[model samples]
Target chain A: MTDDLPPLLLGRLNHVGIACPSIDDTIAMYARLFGATVSTPPFDLPAQGVRVAFIDVANSQLELIEPLGPDSPIHGFLKKNPAGGQHHVCFEVADIIAARDAMRARGATVLGSGEPRIGAHGVPIIFVHPRDTGGVLIELMATPDHY
Target chain B: MTDDLPPLLLGRLNHVGIACPSIDDTIAMYARLFGATVSTPPFDLPAQGVRVAFIDVANSQLELIEPLGPDSPIHGFLKKNPAGGQHHVCFEVADIIAARDAMRARGATVLGSGEPRIGAHGVPIIFVHPRDTGGVLIELMATPDHY
Candidate 1:
């Protein structure tokens, strides 16, 4: 059954999201240490309740997500540790809808299994529950340029 | 100043380490969805106080690490969240020594820079602190069979 599947949605890693208490400090640290360049500047996502900034570190990207308001996911994460930390890893998919469907067939649950929503980097994205992927919060993304 | 360095490290993602409460479930989830076969079976790392298994998921890998003893890193992480989750992401490099040196030059504190320790796949690896990489745990690795 598994052999018949097109492929696993474990696609290329788009970026690793870092939850930070202060996006400015986080950006500075990565810039100084890894010489990471800001590929995507800070932008707000009211729907997701956060602002994000991305720095390209060689092959992978380093993303800094900070909650704008108290209701944001970052807000909840910060309560545990103000420093905030690693958020979720994003994987580039050929088709997010198809990926979600494939994952469901394998006993995985997804937050949104239909159309992709605009996420950081102007890409269509969907979130898969961590419970379904070994408790690792996974984001499936499909960049228009790639598609 | 950022452009002075001769591309500090060779660019490619190595793997993402996931701390799972149930290695069996994690293994099944990945294998069923991604066609990810077990590249390395579960093995106990008494020194690190953890048991680990590895699977190659496309160009990258999915590693399942579980706590075997109380002193293990997995144990501490699991205590924080019993559900288990994404642990760390490793970056592949051509030369570990050169990469470590570059990181140090950039003010990054390496966990074990001088010596490269053998990982689950028998590859040499070193960990970089989250404090230095924008609050994201980073690992640098080199495998003889990789390049």
Candidate 2:
């Protein structure tokens, strides 16, 4: 059955998501230590219930996210890990809907409504459940139009 | 003092380590689902107390690791997470010692003996603690001679 499936086009890793209590502090640390180029001022994503900033590296990015409010999705994660930690990893895909269907056909679980929502990069993204991803929350995002 | 420092040269990400109870199972999943090209057979790294396999991607690799024995460092990780999960992320550096010194100067904690140990890839590698890295266990390795 698996032999009949088409190739899964998991594109390059776009960014790694890090859950931090304070994006400013993390941005400062990255800048001071690694001389990293961090994106200015975290912007709110009410839909995702978090504020996010991007720290650009040579090949990829580190996304720092903080809970937006009490009802934020990452609030529980922050409470459990007050010091912050690696949240999820995002991978780019040329076609998100195709990726979603392929993953689902292979028994991978897609989180939320099983639909791609606009992510911070202004591209459609879907989260694959951790259980199916060997304990990593995997976010599959369509490559931004600009990219 | 920080203003006078040169920019840290963080190379492309090398791989993301996933700790799994069974490398065979994970390899099968990646191959069957993602049509990933996994390295043939898992190799034991007795020094690290783990067996490792690689799944090649376009930009980076996915390292699937399993405990070598009872004393394996990842034994406890698997015990806590029976189903397995993301363990660490590795990045390449031109000079690991210089990277270590810079990180230490900026108050980041290096794990183990604070020295580079020969990693599975046969290169000098050091682990930066998650506490200082926004909760990600970051491995910095000197780029291989061939790379």
Number of the top candidate by DockQ?
Answer: 2
The residue-by-residue lDDT of candidate 1 on A1-147, one tens digit each, is 354644555666777787988887776665565555567778888877898887765557767898888788778777866666767878888777788677777676777545567887677788888776666788888845842
Badly placed stretches (over 4 Å) of model 2 are A1-5, B1-6
Position B83, candidate 1: lDDT: 83
Q: CA lDDT of B45 in candidate 2? A: 92
Alpha-carbon lDDT, every model: 0.73, 0.83
Q: Clashing residue pairs, candidate 1?
A: A8-B34
Q: State the lDDT of candidate 2 residue by residue for A1-147, as single tens digits.
A: 255645756778888888899888887766776677675468999999899998766677788999997888898878767888778888899899998998898899999888899999999999988888777788989987764
Candidate 2 lDDT at B105 equals 84
Kept native contacts, fraction for each prediction: 0.49, 0.53
Candidate 1 versus truth, CA RMSD in Å, comes to 3.4
Q: Write the per-residue lDDT of candidate 2 for residues B65-116, one digit (tens) a residue.
A: 9999789989887876788877888889999999999889879899989889
Q: List the candidate 1 regions with Cα displacement exceeding 4 Å.
A: A1-7, A102-107, A112-115, B1-10, B33-35, B93-95, B98-108, B112-115, B143-147
Q: What DockQ do you compute for every candidate structure?
A: 0.45, 0.55
